[model samples]
Target: MASTTPQGLCIHPRQMDFELPDPLPRHWHGGDAFKSHLFDAMSLQFPDGERFFIDSVRYFREHIGDPQLRKQIRSFIGQEGHHSREHQVYSKRLRDLGYDIDRLEGHVQARIRFTQKRLSPQRQLAATAALEHITAIMAEGLLRDARHLEGAHPTMVRLWRWHALEETEHKAVAFDVYNQVCGNRSLLRRAMLMGTFFFVLDTSRGLVHMLKRDGLLWNWRVWRGGLSWLWGKRGIYRPLLGPYRDFFRDDFHPWQRDSLELLQRLRGEFDGAHQAEEANGPVPS
Candidate 1:
């Protein structure tokens, strides 16, 4: 099973009052419909998804005895709370753009409700840990690669980088909590399987919905280009395959990937900007 969280690790929330563009561009990522909708699909899932993550980790807060773990738990909750609120704003931007935000969210809400009602608390926590692993790897990918956000709008880029920074900060919190409360490798692996299925399914459904609205769903050129961008050599997600598969190992831990250097590098960039933002007063909403 996974070891305790890495030594000297600390988690804290950052306020990133992102003022997303009033009317978000339909093709915000380099004017590519597939790329923009893919990101939009994931953003639409965050408000509710972050809440579920918070509740799952909170359910086991009392079970943890380590002082540091408990402190990290509080910060984790705060960080995810910030993510949920910011993404709710992002979702509203999508709504204003005429995408069916309600319909996309309803499907995720129904699944969360069912999981809470039918699954055990341990299972719920396992799912949270599994999903966290997924996000953590993707966050690391975004941070390590400037190519991922190349040509994106500046404000949107800032918002995503802020999110990625925090995600990297608390990447291990849920995993540590799960390991403390229930160290069942079998359960975790199963959760990964189920969680990956729904994540892909929901993201694809939302992507399709937005593309259809934009009248690009049937455009073969868009699919051809997007698919190449995602799966071809040097693709944005191509590097993440190994990290994603590492979750199934018997001794897997989030820090085994050893991203502390990258984390510190970004902390300098984002923390400096955040301090400046505070000094400048709140961003005009």
Candidate 2:
């Protein structure tokens, strides 16, 4: 039997560590606009998503009557709510820059309604877990590729970095929940659901929107850059994709291919910076 203790799901919310740059990058000008658009879309998507999941919890609690699972569901909802709020603030910054976020928001609402109508709670959770897994992998990949983004806008880079880090931190929660709730479900079915959600809904939507907004969708330069980044010498895609693909296997765990060593290294660097500040005494206000 799986453990239902709160300790099993304990997750620490780390403070945002990355610094946003002052001036934005040139290549990222339109991208930032798109991000603003995307963030608004996420704001719309997340609340509805959260409500659906919360309702799922309520449904399960009534049927299964597991108090521990109920608490876990609440924590998951809280984390997602925080994500929605943060992204909403970030989206407002984009709006302040004069982007039209309303249309983007409308599109998101439509998508959410479509998803709600089409999927069961189990499949919805499966999709969410898959997306979370992808996000986690992308987070680690971005950190590894931060140097490549050096010439990009600082604020955009910082936003992506912070988003990536948080994604990595909470990657396991949804999957764990999905596994716990969907008892006796085959891993193969879960894997197929995840792949379909990402490839069809998430990735395809992102690519189409990006292309329409930036005119870079079919551009060889953008394609080359993306491919190079994903498959290049220092590419993180290989390691990142491994665990996700293996998720269909009977032995899969959320942490199976985790970049734990890298995570630890980054944590050490963060701690060391704090120690250095302490050693130098408090700075003048």
- Clash count for each candidate, listed in order shown: 0, 1
Q: By lDDT, who's the top model here?
A: 1
**What's the lDDT for all of these models?**
0.88, 0.52
Cα-lDDT of candidate 1? 0.88
Residues 137-205, candidate 2: write the lDDT tens digits.
667876777543455556665655555555565566566666667843474356456554644464345
How far out, in Å, is residue 151 in model 2?
Answer: 3.5
Report the C-alpha lDDT of model 1 over 1-285, residue by residue, as the tens digit.
636566766465777788899888879999989988898999988999999999999999999998777778888888899999999999999999999999999999999999999999999999999999999999999999987788988988888888888898889999989988898999999999999999999999999999999998999999998998888898899999999999999999998898878876777656665543221222211
**Candidate 2 has which clashing residue pairs, if any?**
25-153
Model 2 TM-score on a 0 to 1 scale:
0.65
Q: How much is the lDDT of residue 157 in candidate 1?
A: 88
TM-score of each: 0.94, 0.65
